[model samples]
Target: SQQGEEDPQALSIQEGENATMNCSYKTSINNLQWYRQNSGRGLVHLILIRSNEREKHSGRLRVTLDTSKKSSSLLITASRAADTASYFCATGRNTGKLIFGQGTTLQVKP
Candidate 1:
């Protein structure tokens, strides 16, 4: 079953601005991870927050998880044109099946 579902579906921002995207999932998760994709190809692992964790940050990326709410949010600070890509939230299962969010497309204009 598809669990992680990203909101808005798309986003646009200017360089230096901030971009925020959200994800909502169905079942309990062991760990939630964020990924970035360029031109709809390949996935770059951004950050991962465990079920026991509430929040985490890595460089320009910040991730928050609320297992109680079965949701997560991703924030990108100081956005750059290079940041133009699609962001997705993924749920990891002990079964080794990784479910990915639909994705939020972000276009950072320079």
Candidate 2:
């Protein structure tokens, strides 16, 4: 398994619905971060949850981390059509590098 890999490959939802995505990592990590990438654009950091923290939230985004299972989940509340993008999970290493997940493509319909 890769260091940071996301499940469900892709997801589609109607506007105003909630979107949930999951990620799993193989090795130990200091923190896990989520990023959103629009088509043909750079990634935008969404949230970062430390190993010691169980959960964190930023506006419409909610993240949950489970160090025991080596997994994390991202929840986007009240999703909008503009929210369509690819979401990736990144494992923060001690060496100041991040191992990114394969990413989950989300399509929010209007």
Candidate 3:
């Protein structure tokens, strides 16, 4: 099974700061998605950028894809304390299964 790996196992930042995380995958993928998980909350989809797409943005979230490098990145602008959570990158396959990365934990202090 193909898998994605996130860098900087953890991160810390003050409220209203910016946070950046990267993800690298093993094989070709249909799409790459970013998700956020709060302490005890379910994973919430942050954004999805297709393999052919270079970049996408949603509110304060920005995502970039590099198919040639088999990598992707997520940037959160002006992050808030409520944004403290675990971020994961998922590679979607034709089978409809998503392979998740280990994740990056971000702590935002108010």
Against the true structure, whose lDDT is highest? 2
Number of the top TM-score candidate: 2
The 10 consecutive residues of candidate 1 with the worst lDDT sum are 1-10
In model 2, what is the error at residue 67, expressed in angstroms? Answer: 0.2
Candidate with better lDDT, 2 vs 3: 2
lDDT by residue (4-99, candidate 2, tens digit) is 679879999999999999999988999999999999999999999999999999999999999999999999999999999999999998989998
Comparing 2 with 3 on TM-score, the higher-scoring candidate is 2
C-alpha positional error of residue 62 in candidate 2 after TM-score superposition, expressed in Å: 0.5
The lDDT of each candidate is 0.91, 0.94, 0.93
Prediction-by-prediction clash tally: 0, 0, 0
Compute each candidate's TM-score over C-alphas: 0.95, 0.96, 0.95
Model 1: lDDT of residue 53:
98
lDDT of 1 by residue, 6-104 (tens): 886999878999999999999888999999999948999899999999999999988999999999999999999999999889999888888998999
